[model samples]
Target: MRQTLSNPPSGKKTIKQRFLKLLPCCRSDSTSPIIQNSVDDDFELSTVCYRPEGLDKLMQVTKFDKRELQILYRSFKSECPSGAVDEETFKLIYSQFFPQGDSSNYAHFLFEAFDKQKNGAVSFDDFVTSLSIILRGSVTDRLSWAFNLYDLNKDGCITKEEMTSIIKSIYDMMGTYTYPCIRDDAPKEHVESFFQKMDMNKDGVVTMEEFLASCQKDENIMQSMHLFENIL
Candidate 1:
């Protein structure tokens, strides 16, 4: 993807728009509950969130078959002892976590993720850049938790629909966690509402053109990567 913004200062922000750094968060820190929430356990979604390296570890080691359940079990052991799934659980239930289904869907998901312009097609860098965003928090917080949050359907890969919903959840979550830094309000809603209208061509889609037209930031992308830089 382009390392630079889509358009220059000579432009606008698209529709009702809203808009990672990582930390080696210690196992425990008690400044505030949200900060404290940074702690990890296997079952907790926070623990599941992971960056590129971690995702690579996950994809590399994870079994494509029944072995998935075992890993889930370990996560539960680390994070939640009370509500773990039993050995008798079916594979389909676990399937819910794999948000992207087959190869085609994975391709689509990757396309959206890496498509810097949002026109939908994977780029080498945008696809890889999210690693920085993913690595911004504890393993659980970045992967499982982020996954769980974005995977509204409980499926593993975040779909375009899921992405739309999550864009909102992302803001709400940020406001909640960084209440002091950023006031609590519907910033995500602002962004989404704008995007909906910016579907100006009525294509039922929003483009990077529409997006760039809308934000004040020099770089109007999701800016998730900043978390890694900011935290550091």
Candidate 2:
């Protein structure tokens, strides 16, 4: 049987209980009910069809016209069951459902959503929580996402030089086609500094073991590595 993006509802179980266990891979405020509610609310809002009369209104959600709804349904029907939503998929959905220069993209929404207190940037905690909210896949999928960041050389082992390349690839994937868009968020000096962090053993290069150790504590990361090895 194909998997649904979300597990089928176990009748009679409360949403609170469900929410408590949903994102096992994340380190969220398990005690704060408000954070939990905000994440859920944002997710529900995203699923609605959004219409806009102008760029300023692009972010507002609205009712979908019958014809527009049909197109949305047919388009989604074309996808395979294994192709459930992910950050990349969400971006496409937003673009098709609501279009207005970058307003239709997930990046802008994500940046704005996580920029709490009206700060232009997001805290690491906020960013990770939001990502966990969007990515429902288990630990394995999360690991794949991280590995996908570092395995830019695609040779499996990540050396220092390859580490820098991987960071650059991540920025490129985020929709910046420039040579080094990572420099936008991270200074060129800071971007290069990631190699220092990854080179944990200080042997001048990093092996899979070293990289895994740094992120191994994250169950999501390990699950991905396990799945990756099995696939290979």
Candidate 3:
């Protein structure tokens, strides 16, 4: 996986495209309201095999056996009181982990990924599976997730406009404390550098293949992707 950054072999599917195929199959519509003030009761009730089929599938994807899954679900339900966590709630909760409570951009992208159904909220199932990937998935899995985060339009590619927008949002999330007090032109410069290395064919757009290739070869990028690991 650490060869030169280049187009994947023809006929070999990009990880991002393959991941997109799996996304539809993985989504769940579990809208059961969170049992507030009943964590113990919820644990007891869960022992009876509620949503056995769904739980089975979740375990299959997450590799978290019954006990671990139950523990995570209990924790998730405790935080998401309404059975689902809305973006605002997620942002607020996620921000608390940051030194300045300024994780808005990262949290926004993470919430978007976890909200698999694009329904403006994250269900318990959604929370568990996505967290599993972030916590334990392989590098390829993490890269696919990163690509999904940057491909804001869901069009299977990243455009210059999207890169600029995302970078701007990240800077905005940093508030006034963003170091170096970078110039106004910094975002464009960053976007240009990204395209220079990642666009491959200079088509003014970056396909998932290119993004994966570039990131895979860059040790710093790979390391940075796991920056939140300790906090998590």
Candidate 4:
């Protein structure tokens, strides 16, 4: 049976309700009914089609045309029954692909990048914008997005601890694949190597400048930018 957007799973809260729940923590006057109305306004705004100028800009920026964008939006909304996907839902959806290990941390980082609003939930606009960049944006755009994810503290720098944690999450997600199992320290070694190569200032922290300069110079980084695009 085909499910329309109107027919979300029974007993589950609607996406609007979920957004309301998210609003309280984000605002100073969360208890006010006016705040609830503001949330309602924002939710309505997010679901609207892009204006003609905006659509034209999107076509210019991304590979998706109008028809393609419509199709993708439908699929994205259907998968997310609530009309928006929170981090936990995003993590669960991604973890299924790995089938061997915990991908919670990687999904966490990926979701952070996707939540362009930084409001703890991904709107349709957020999903499309981030996806377009990952699939077809320029090298500089992709690298900048990645650095944002690695900069967990949002302090404009990537720390060794943050890099190690993300790398460890990725390795954990990889699990024991093939005949030769990966050692526990493999992620640590990988982090060390990455920092050794990219940390140009020897300050133990990588600024965005260093990340971009190093990534732009690396043949491997340039080659690997589109690796995930094929899967999409």
lDDT winner: 4
Query: What digit string (tens of lDDT, one per residue) describes model 2 on residues 91-180?
Result: 554343222223232244333444434455443334334344334445444554445444544465666555554333323333332223
lDDT of 1 at 94: 23
Candidate 1 per-residue lDDT, tens place, 28-120, comes to 245422344343432454444335565555444332222232333343344334433222131232223222221233323323443445543
Ranking by TM-score: 4, 3, 2, 1
Q: Where is model 2 more than 4 Å wrong at Cα?
A: 1-76, 79-141, 169-187, 216-232
Weakest 10 consecutive residues of candidate 3 by summed lDDT: 1-10
Quantify all predictions' global Cα lDDT against the true fold: 0.34, 0.39, 0.65, 0.66
Let me know the TM-score candidate 4 reaches against the reference structure: 0.71
Model 3 RMSD vs true structure: 11.6
Number of backbone-clashing residue pairs for each candidate, in the order shown: 51, 3, 0, 0
1-232 per-residue lDDT for model 3 (tens digits) = 0121123334544333332232222223342222233576556646644477988888888856666666566555556657798999878766644434256876787678788999999997887777677646888887787778778878999999888877666555444443455468877887887788788989989998888888799886666444333223
Once model 2 is optimally superposed onto the true structure by TM-score, how far is the C-alpha of residue 125 displaced, in angstroms? 32
The predicted structure with the larger lDDT, 3 or 4, is: 4
For every candidate in turn, the CA RMSD to the true structure comes to 15.7, 17.7, 11.6, 13.9
TM-score-best of 1 and 4? 4
